[model samples]
Target: MFGSFITMLTGIRILKNINKSLLGIIKYEKPIDKGIEIAGYDYDSVQDIFYSNMNAWQRNMGYSRLYDEASAPFGMIVDCEPIYFKYNNRIWLIELWKGQYDLNTGCEVGVYTAEKPILNLPEVYKYMFYNCASDEDRLTISLSLKKNGKTLFALDDKHWWLAGFKLGEYSEPSELVMYLNITLKDEEMCSSFVEAIKKIGYEENKEFIVNGNTVGLTFDKPHTTQPITRTEQTDKIIQMKNKLLCDKYNDITRVYSNLTDKINAIQKQAPEIYSEIVDKAVLRKYLRSMKNTETE
Candidate 1:
């Protein structure tokens, strides 16, 4: 009974509304030349996507989860080479550089991180996701270094996540496990949610996630030219209709505002003309009265 109680107190508990975004898991190394293929993922699986993210993040500044918006392909962030954004605030998040390679080895090196870009991104993401001030989740990693025959590469870890996480698929693994406890608030917010999924289990070499409840990308990552639910075309039509309506509304509003501004400017710049128009109308009324008396 005592042991059971302790296990309840100490067991792994994931947070409520456990978003994949708030959790970032990186698996990296001295990069496999972008030529070495990962069995489960893609060629760009380990490289091309970071460039995509850098481009998107540059344009949007950040995304809004409240609107179900994410930078379209989120997994690409994983392909980034391990780098620390230069600033302390940016340190928490990972970056994808446009360039890398060792000058000494001529191994086609990867890109290095720029200082300012690094500084802004971490804070930008932290602000966007880690909104509350409560104690954040942190991971402690344990990895062992090995060599494969004559090849001087780190073994057991096929890859790593960020500067903090290391994972290997073909090679042996230096395992990583996280230690976290649910806060009182986290527990309160998710009691029923917790009850529904208490039976959920974690598997070994099974591609576990940084967030406790979710599963890692094991053998079955999907690829599609479009969304999974194609039958929702009708619903999507409705949504499109709504969006067009909103856009039209916004356009009309902008036109109205611009016209109002022009009118205000005309009034301000030509007050004399406005007064003359009003005065002429009054003078015409007097002339009509005089003409009526003469005709009578």
Candidate 2:
């Protein structure tokens, strides 16, 4: 009972969210002919700076649960190699480049994080079906990841409306197992989306597996062509829509301001003309005088 309690406290826990800003790539070494170097602890002066930044994160968050595992993949950051680091037990990919790499004048580094947590993989899977407009979606009650890094999504036998998730064919060896929900409106749209993925260098069945409902993809390392996330796309569309609305409102305000300024100028410079046009009583008198003058 004591061991069980301890496990509950230390075992895998779902993260509420990941702060990308907390994970930044710092350049510690200049590029040489071979490659740039990620500052190792042995490099005392530079290591201080690296740890100084890392300390900020450590002070803010708790230690990672998977920090000590032999297969955890965290190591000294190095150039030209993709390092898999565990940040709070969530896998992240950090890649460093040498100056020899095209389009880069100096050493550069990049850090990529999973869009969703591993604990949330099942939920992400269900969301995919919902995004697909599938009549149903679900995971089995006994959902578990296999030693071979695979899992199944099954629906209720009696209740078709309940939800259904299925495991499709897979090809790559992946440390991370997850599903991508691509819910395009129609076949043409789906084809375009698939093409977009392919254009970024993903192959069908080898790098990704597709089925009637779910699209299964794995992330052993950072992917060149990432799965299209529905939430991100929606957020982008909303942002763009907001920007356009704001622009339109500003344009309308500017035109209204220009007209208001012209009216005020007339009122100041030509009070009679302004009153004749604007004031009801003055305009009525002006009209009556004009009529009498025309009659004479």
Candidate 3:
């Protein structure tokens, strides 16, 4: 019975993982590099020269962190900046690389002109990225998760720079992006898509109806502020108990002062629910605070 319950929990987590991946880009056997003036040069020779340098780096243990998951195996290449430098002779090389991948695959995609992850991730509940451990620059990750606005789990660990996620079968073409999979729990992860949704600039406290062309949506909100967290629920019940006890004692903790004493006073009092509730509340509060700081 115990093992079965654990297995079911594991399966539920896997379902979430599978569903989230549906939002990422997918391709294979394709180096995402494009638009370079290896100009007037044979493609074969350029590829060979690239490999020669790559082989030397591999021999020097430079790519040792190739399989690192902290290395954002998936992300989007958002920029391409040009640069020129001179050593023995005048030479031009793209100095910035900017791309995105599934942080677990260690693949570089998008349009990186030789740049890497420039932002820190304090809350990584829903994404993976390049994490590195180098004698020089280090890779680090600090992110948290909040599902349905409730803290779930967290960690603050240093990782090496990463590249991409492992290639899986493509479900759709590049045109139909899986809409940035953000769970109700991922309050922050869906920001990009959310902004896109807002860009339509058509809020309808009243409907903006188009006779035969425009679409429709309503923006009436139907919820209250600060919905009860699990801890809040637990806190409410405890507050009730404390108030009842205080009133009975004419304002003294004396009523439950011997609560633990009573626990031992009885043969088996089912392990005082009040103590269990309070302990849980305290631990959860601490953990939630930690997770919140991780993103900040």
Candidate 4:
């Protein structure tokens, strides 16, 4: 009976050590990224700069969260200050946040319209998307936006004129929403974007809302298109030729000499055909055969 009691004590001690080790990990080993750091600014300076320049709504929201002393048990809560930059002669604001349980951070970017009209709306849209996206996300976002030669507008560039967008977070959808600024002028760019949104199957008052030049748009139901494939034989030939040139060969000069001889042989074999035509045909056939064999 005493031996059994000692065994129970030893098991309890083992569990206690394990529990202590887990607690240490939970306290110190969080997966959060290093906190935000802006160039040429300390922590206190960053806070002061953001607070002084923020709009009333932004000030209220930031301070309310900043001063909150609520306990967070799941993940560490951080109060990050907004950062500013100048693009297209306008001051742009970027606000970052990491919630108590959030594994990844979220950000909202905004910029007031320039006094003068923007010459290129598509360029601005591309810049905004890229600025907010991470390095890994840039290519994906670019391909999605540029798919099928479509911009923010379904219509061609000639048809659209003025366009602006605002980015912010929404609670109900729990995602970033783009609020488009539409103008009533003849060259207004907003109507086309709205029409494009409709074409993609978004509904008014359901997926989006418009309030006097500001259209709050949600992208819950995204439109998918078949991935673009290179179907041109010429393009494929060029790619194969490039690959062949880049490939490691024991004698690159000898390979080129062989290719030239093959071209000459094709010219000799098809004397009736134009010299240019014979040369191109031989090169294309050789590259195509090489590509096929490589695939095999």
Candidate 5:
């Protein structure tokens, strides 16, 4: 009976271990099987599946690795979902996945049609050009204008600079009347910028409508340099002499006041020592006489 009881416990333990193993297998099953053709090409790994759908340009632009890695999976199983967005009067789908397989890890995004037999879809050329124009230091400035509820055109960062002008925008309503402002430090730079814009068919202070908003370009010219006449030069010289004399007099008065304060402090802190330097009665009489003269 003792031997039978031990054999029964051993059988129970074996069953429990088998149950745990099966549960783990079901929990961590690979979502995509090996040799699946989700991207129109057979892929054994998630990255392979993602890259197979990307075109040469997208691959070269490094869109495959542009995803948040902290949320990536650690094991073989991956979570994939489709994101739908409308652009240019057409609906598009993006398949995004996150997981790890062997040494490969992180998330990836790929564009495809929403229908079955998924084929790779390319991003809009204008969006792609503007978005990818940024560098490590300088971000590309872009303006998107829509006319009659449709995209008219987009101006990227290099466009204004190439036209030999720097543009700035204002948020205040008063300044917003001149929507795009071209401000240069000197008159020469302003003139050159004006010429450059005129070459491109843009007129100064011309009003146009963009996206139902009245848009206009305004130029801010620097203050002009003026020549000084002989009389003005003489007046400026006299003003400078007066200012210097006043400044010197003020400095001397400040020094005298500071010395008087120090002497008074010394007299209070060490009266006996101060008495050896000068007679207190004589000092007070002299200060009083000077004060009377100043009042007169």
Candidate 6:
């Protein structure tokens, strides 16, 4: 019976590993460069290059403030100054439009001069998430799960720099917004997504009406009006210490229970060879210690 129980637990552990492998793989890849740094490019030169290479589509229709000009596809919308930069002598422009993507009225797009191929879709995302911190400089990193059950890395068409400074009543600090579409197919992906967000201390606001399958998210840097204190650190240390103690206690309890069952069986068969090494006093002592720790 003991051997069978061990085999069952081992099988369960294997199944969990298999499940994790079946889910989509997420990779964080870094950028490449020569001796020169590409990130700290001059702003005016980048903007001028981007303006010189604008396609007729963007030039004729793309106004600076479409929302305020009363030509916005969406209702009154927030605005942020477009970002431009040059990397490896290539000019790039990032524009946020009131109606950029097909589904969402607002979207952000990064354009380049196309003299040489710029970073692919995935590389663009890695640069945003791993390299950049400014809202104006980063793209929304999202996971797309379509109705057909295909999962892929997705980016929001609209990127708002600080969600457009002082737009309406949103007075929060600078932050980034990401969107996930058609998320119903995979439970593991959704669970991991939420846990990953929590691990980074990002708050989720669910007031947008994107659709049942779609999820909109934003993450801001942690803030506190109060000054930092030693008491806060002490509290965190205490909480972690208690958690470690509790985990150890639970593991010990499980082993003790299994051993006790075996001891009882052996005692019934041959009391001379097998006897109770543990008594009520020992158990009581352990329980009292745990209680004392909790009180402390």
Give the number of the best model, judged by lDDT. 5
Question: Compared with the true structure, what per-residue lDDT tens digits does model 1 show for residues 17-134?
Answer: 1222122211322112111221111212232111111121112121112111111111111111122222222222221211111000001011211224333543343223211111
Candidate 4 Cα errors over 4 Å, as ranges: 1-35, 39-102, 105-187, 224-296
**TM-score per candidate:** 0.17, 0.21, 0.16, 0.23, 0.17, 0.19
lDDT of 2 at 8: 32
Rank by TM-score (best first) = 4, 2, 6, 1, 5, 3
Clashing pairs in 4: none
lDDT, residue 70, model 1: 15
TM-score of candidate 4 to 2 decimals: 0.23
**C-alpha-based local distance difference test score of model 4:** 0.26
At residue 74, candidate 1 shows an lDDT of 12
As a whole number from 0 to 100, the lDDT of residue 248 in candidate 6 is 39
lDDT of 5: 0.27
Ten consecutive residues with minimal summed lDDT in candidate 2? 69-78
lDDT of 2 by residue, 47-70 (tens): 111111121112222112121111
Position 167, candidate 5: lDDT: 9
Model 4 C-alpha lDDT per residue in residues 65-104, reported as the tens digit of each score: 1111110111112222232333344323222222211111
Q: What's the lDDT for all of these models?
A: 0.22, 0.26, 0.22, 0.26, 0.27, 0.26
Count residue pairs with overlapping backbones in model 3: 51
280 Cα displacement, candidate 6 (Å): 79
Worst lDDT 10-window in candidate 3: 33-42
Supply every candidate's count of residue pairs whose N, Cα or C atoms clash at under 3 angstroms.
19, 4, 51, 0, 0, 5
lDDT of 3 by residue, 190-212 (tens): 23223323443433334222222
Q: Is candidate 2 or candidate 3 better by TM-score?
A: 2
Please give the distance, in angstroms, between residue 209's alpha carbon in candidate 2 and its true position after superposition.
3.9
What does candidate 6's lDDT look like per residue over 1-296, in tens digits? 44334334443543464344223221212111100012111112211111111122122222221112221111122222232333343333333322111111122233222122355442332122111123333333332212123221233332212111110111111222323332322344344434434444445554222334343542122222111111345434533433443333333334433433433444355442221111111211121111111112
